[model samples]
Target: MAIMAGPGDPVLAETAAERIRELMDGGFVVDADGQHAPVHADDLAVISPHVEQASAIAARLADVPGVLIGTANHMHGLEREAVVVIHPLVGYREAPACATGLGRLCVALSRHRAYATVIVDADADLVLAHAQREAPRDARLATQRHVLAALLALG
Candidate 1:
């Protein structure tokens, strides 16, 4: 997908942008500010927190559908366009960010009527069958909030 890693970080943004542009047959040529987008992903830092920037990139990136992924070393806010932020632990002390875990993530994407399911991928299907079971909505969300609180405490 097309990308513009937030401000100050240009490396990742440039590489991701270049790859996406190549995949897009070179249609991606503009940045959030209407300038020529970077040529590689390593040219990124933290993408601007402006929705316009996101919209610009999303427009080009949407060519690849069903691709739900994002990355962060230590996420501090709602990472736009990401259904999941892979942090060792998420922290939300002042706000109830993970009061709904994946549900909240779905809600943030405007899809709230969701079911909470945790899946474990491995070679043994039978062993992971039960491991992939769904959790009660409220309970799962509570667990997420609790985990976030714990992370905040540890930090």
Candidate 2:
């Protein structure tokens, strides 16, 4: 599922942290290695494309014991029962190549076993639209822009 944190919203990482806290309230169960069980702190992960963003989310989640938080690259081979991904374009007016890469987005979204929540800025599509004005020259970015657009549309 996706949630939009608009330009006027709280810091993106804070918004994600709030959602994570709420998810931990109770009664949530997830499949772990094919067995169903109540979700634990250790079963949750918070992922972002940037290290600083991950670190900021980690600071806010310090009170929530055992949750793994890290950049998408840092989490490449890991999986969790649930994941909250802070969309890299959340605070940007234009898309950054580093964040718009298809691989990074895929890694961030695919690391979940049962549930996934992506927190994106409401204006992300606009940002990508602005970036698209010059995207055709770069085929890879053009492709990524299409994928990002589809993800936003899914929300």
Candidate 3:
């Protein structure tokens, strides 16, 4: 599943990434090619809407036992057990300026086939609202919402 963390806060993104690493037992791997390659238990992947953020996260996780970081573009068409998306709301409001970026974020969230997605952000409602507006008639978005609801309900 694809998880989102944001309002474009770097601190939150970093913190969320760290927490996820802990939950995964410090196991995460980068799909490098987004080929849906096999990942071990210790493998962890971080996806970000911005290259700078992704790179920063990668650098911060450099010493982690088992973690890989990259932008959503790098993991296109790939599937993993879990994916953490940081600062997904970066350009959510500025549609024109971030049209490509927003599209990338959506593609990253939708294309990546994960069992669970952990979205970390202060304003999840805003994120959802923007997403609904962006893709009101998209079936994929509907499915994603359903799955996310189910996951939340399970907890």
Candidate 4:
């Protein structure tokens, strides 16, 4: 079962780990290389309120240089903000939402590029992991550089 913390307290890493455990139902199912494991969960419905709160916080955090994931306030800030929007997985898509579990977040932060990606949940581990994914905050870090480059090249 997923451990619940106090209303305002930050979720401990262990709590996140525990939640991850609960999502997978105990045993971690990893692939051949053991890079990313499978996670089971669906939609932002589980934590819509939390996603809203995080989005609010992200709105406040906007203009500062950070990306908030999983909130209603889609894109924030001016000056060519390249936010990586990861939609919730309908049915085992390539990239899934963090609402379901941290495994997909792990995959994205470990693999995909995102500067200020918004998650559909208030999972701090996913946020921290994404932050750690791109330490220097490359707004264009996890973006389609090729497409962007092509567009820019036309200009």
Residue-wise C-alpha lDDT for candidate 2, range 60-133, written one tens digit per residue: 99998899999889998999888998876777776777767878888998999888888876667777777877
Regions of candidate 2 where Cα sits further than 4 Å from its true position: 1-10, 30-36
- Show the lowest summed lDDT stretch of 10 residues, model 1: 112-121
Winning model by lDDT: 2
Most TM-score-accurate candidate: 2
Per-candidate TM vs. native?
A: 0.21, 0.82, 0.54, 0.21
Give per-residue CA lDDT, model 4, range 1-155, as digits (tens). Answer: 12244222233222332333344454233456866543332211111123543444344334333232342223222211123333232111122233334333333333212122222223433433454365545333233222223333543
The lDDT of each candidate is 0.31, 0.77, 0.55, 0.31
Error of 4 at 32 (Å): 32
Query: For each predicted model, how many residue pairs clash, with residues at least 3 apart or on different chains?
Result: 23, 0, 12, 8
Instruction: Tell me which of candidates 3 and 4 scores higher on lDDT.
Output: 3
In candidate 3 the C-alpha lDDT for residue 45 amounts to 62
Candidate 1 per-residue lDDT over residues 1-155, each given as its tens digit: 11123221333333333444453353223556877642332222222222343344444456555332232212234232212111211111122332234543333333111211111112223222222343334454454445444433543
Q: Which stretches of candidate 1 lie over 4 Å from their true place?
A: 1-33, 43-134, 139-155
**Using alpha carbons, what is the TM-score of model 1?**
0.21
What local lDDT does model 4 show for residue 55?
48
> Every model's Cα RMSD, please?
14.7, 3.6, 7.3, 17.8
